[model samples]
Target: MPNQNDSDSNIHALLIGIDNYSSTSLFKSLEGAVRDINLVEAFLKNTLKLPTERIRRLIAPNREDTVLLVARSAHEPEPTYENIVKAFTELTEAAQPGEQIYIHYSGHGGRATTIYSDLKGEGQSDEGIVPMDIGQPDGRYLRDVELATLLKRMTDKGLVVTVILDSCHSGGTTRGDYAIRSSGETDTAIRPRESLVGSREELINNWRSLTEGIHRTAWIPVSRDYVVLAACRPTESAYEYSVNGKERHGALTYWMLDTLNTLPGTLTYKALHDRVGAKIQSKFPSQLPMLLGEGDRAIFGTNRISTHYTVTVLQVNASQQRVKLNAGLANGLDSGTRFAIFPFNTADFANKQKQVAIVEVTDIEASSATARVLAEVEGGIGVKGQIEPGAPALLLAAPTDLVRRVRFHDQKQLGEAENELPTQALVDQQKEALDAVRQALAGNGWVMEVQPGEEGHYQVALGKNGEYEICIGMPIKNLNPPLMFRDAAAPREVVQRLVHLTKYQSVQELDNPASELMDALEFILLDQNKQPFPNPSNITLKHGTKAYLRVKNTASQALNVAVLDLEPTWQISQIPLRGNNAAFYELAPQETADIPLRFTAPEGAAYQQAKEMLKLFATRGAADFRWLRLPPLDHVIEKQHEATRGIQSAFGKLLEAVGTEPNAAPVMTRAAVYEPDPNADWVTKQIQVTIVPESLLPD
Candidate 1:
């Protein structure tokens, strides 16, 4: 782990928190923003032992509230548009090379019409933080473009920066008991004179110069010098809730502080993010924290990478031996899922000695679960004392009945005549290959040999020489060409291909008919002119024609959405916002997003019609569905590993279970057990479209 003490002098911070606004009707006063900054300041001074002079504070406190514990300093300036800009300028000019800067903001985020449409590329709106002076003559938002420009100035000077935003870009209304941290959408446009630093023309020219050579349609420019820890997705709301049953605080800020206090000076930003996300989702299932840019870097140091996913132990009942976890059906927990309890600070679960106990899920709710302790280690090495709240429960295993059934076809089944039989040695080789494959799959929990009377999901037929052909069923008549392997293919290689096929099948078969989100989401296919296609289920478009997909969220809650393109060549890839570096497309309640689509025939084929499927996935909380992506069958078989972030280990293990290869050690952190959250109420909707040659069009 990197030592923070060695670089304490090089660290500086700027904390901005706003709870009051000039336009009260437009932006409601928050109860937690002022307190958030106070807590952060306390951490820096008391915990990190940083000098007071190294930290700068700007705040807008509610004047009528006397219950706020932390008294605002008179010297601290309000977080108005001008003061905020001046602070950024001062920090950039004063900070030395190689120093670290931490910027934290807790306020309302808003969206408005973009002032420079040409510079914004395809986006017509700009998202920004609403300053305290907004609604006044000179009041305006500090837009994302302007913020990126400011951060670039700091990074260009060789300084490492980290930004924490406890606000969201969309969603305005409160949900249940939580108050949203958003100012809603605005039609007010920002003028060129509103540039933070330079004149309008200079800022535009500088922004254009900075974005030169980069993808022009990107909503926000990508940068590696800094990382942003956002409270929620762009489509969702950031809430201020009573975290401790007393005072309110931004959910992200509270959980983040809790993680830091428990495991201070020992985590990278990525690890911190994972821990914080788990905790926040436990209470606010609708909010998912986002980590953008250089997530692998150390908290305040230059570079590092590691992550671990675990549910928090919210409570323990000694008499009943039942512990409640901060995860439930919404987090993908089931009745039989098991976990190994570890200390909150345990970074590596590979160390078996650090385990405290083993537990199994007994009951589940929408956002929480109850588990019973099955066994306690004789001695807890890492975490002393008994199990308590906030302990990390690493996934041990999940009980699942999902299996891949395969039927192997003999030469007769392939329609070969007996007189064409090869030499006796060739028959022996074929038998040897079948036995090798069966043996390799024997221990796999996910793959099973089809019984005599049982149906199989896949049929594998051995070729005349030594090649193999795999398809969905026995005949393989009209379906796309069978996934073929060359002669002399190794049994292990063949098994890996089967594993990939299993993954492809599993993703396609994913469904949640009982989910409320299923009805909340609507997927529409559009033609060249952006009009809805008449027959969406049986769509046909000329090759290379302009197409579009519009996703609308009609539910009261926000959703994190993504579009996966299942190509005719049997490859699955994410389509929407591709190459734009967006984490996922967020659709606010009753909001819609449009994604452009283009279809073309396979290479070297002049006139052909191919079928393609588009799958849209939406969840109340954030879920990484990138695990569903697979390379085309014709493409070379390269080993692809899922990201080690959230439920990746769970997904990886599913693939690993049906293979003969030894389990690979995690890259930086131990593998997390995969628990599919049904409570996230995830839903998938797919559309099939047929692409035809342009010459086939009727005059």
Candidate 2:
């Protein structure tokens, strides 16, 4: 053995061996050379604390840095010992001081000395890896002494070198049936070798022929500092089983990788063997992890591992318009980093909430850069976008009418006081528009009422006498965040102006000699509330009675005369009023339309006849089915026609004529009053009346 040297500060390791020969090349096997090399590299980097950036990997002819000599030539023809030596020499020259270098090889092995046979000729074989340099002169195989010398030289320099050999060597040696063919072959199939070892003699002969005293080191104890783990004993052959899954390596590699980070500490050469042995034993119960080494040395380093964390959303402070969250250490998360917020579907917020788009952080004073962000969700029609922290983002709604209160979904009224409430201006505009609609309808005899809805919304209801139900509904507030509105109403005087039934009735006798007869005419004025406006002044009118009718237009807009469709016979002269166009003018509040009426009494008993005729036509329950509803008639005869047909055939015709005529004769008998129904419609009411002797008038 060579002596140790001082230049040993730069410790290095060389792990070399062939996984197979031409007969059993390692390149194509389950635990192939490539797999073992890759495994060892990973073991050092991940399990041994070696930084991946600092490691250099070399493989055969593809990478010229390392010699490909150890690889099978049948599989990889470019590899040769000379090239390998050249590369190693260069590596030695470039190596840095105090640097620990590791070199690994996992392939075929050979022993003793023999002449090498190639396609060309024979040559000296120096423990040469088979199939790389074929056909040479001399055909001399390397002796055990020569190989030992090389190992001694490396050890003497204080470099840690690990060499692993997994191949058949002798007869008595335990050998596996595993075999591999070169990749170059068209049919590179794996099969069992025919050769078998039975006794120690055959084993001894095989060992002696490879190298003199090659098994010498196998008998000595190993050192912890330098190590070598072989696949088999000196007299045994390394074997491999099929790796069943998607694994690239055999059992040994699999166990190492799986347990590397899981293991308690660095696997010193000896400890590695024990651990691997335990693993293998637990699995196979027959095989053990093999070990070969010298000197004691610690193997790997501690503190080499990997880690994982979660992101969660905290409080979403809408008033401030900011979200808060807790964040631990993480990657790719910063204040300005963009993030998308989606509703949590797992629990309380289970897909019920809407998801917002991506947003960037404007400020991050309280939370970490990676902290979860909260987004403000807006409601109402066409609402979108996120709200900032502590911002006013609620949708505000107000009632459209003063009579009703605004209520939330929970039925809570929205108000600050008994009458006044907090609301947006938009609600007020909505109310104004709504009131305009109500007034317009009211002018045409439609009774309307408006009520405030939740969130400044408004509800409109039409009375039984009104024209339509669903009024024009619009949001007072815009369909954006901070939605709000207020209430509005129609002009007060417009609501107040009406037909004064009480005043009309109170002066009945002043305008008519027959006060009791005129007193029977009931009158009512319906207000905006649809409630009856009490007419305290009961009034009535008789034939030839003169009464002045007054009408007032108290609206903010122009009032159409068509609204007051009055009965004829009451001659009316419209008087001009201030603050309004007498023709088509906008009438200001409290303006009155003075209307005068003229009536003329009939000759003889004409007044009595007109009164009876008017009464007959005016009763809801028919006083005379033979008569039509008509305005009170005048003194002048419209035009009389002689009896074209006798009263019998013309009776029905006369009743029908009464309906068509503005002024017709009164029903003088009970038979005339209660005429037989022609259409037989039950909706039509008929009543019986008898003309008494008192009803007749003297000429």
Go through the candidates in order and give each one's C-alpha lDDT.
0.66, 0.30
For each candidate, give its TM-score against the true structure. Answer: 0.63, 0.29
lDDT of 2 by residue, 384-477 (tens): 3443211111101111121122111112133554223244432234344335544543421112342443332233322122211221143111
Candidate 1: tens digits of C-alpha lDDT, residues 239-321 = 89887787889988988888778664566665666567656654655676766667667676765645454566656665537
For model 1, name the residue pairs that clash. Answer: 296-304, 329-679, 330-679, 331-677, 332-676, 332-677, 650-674
lDDT for residue 357 in candidate 2, whole number 0-100 = 30
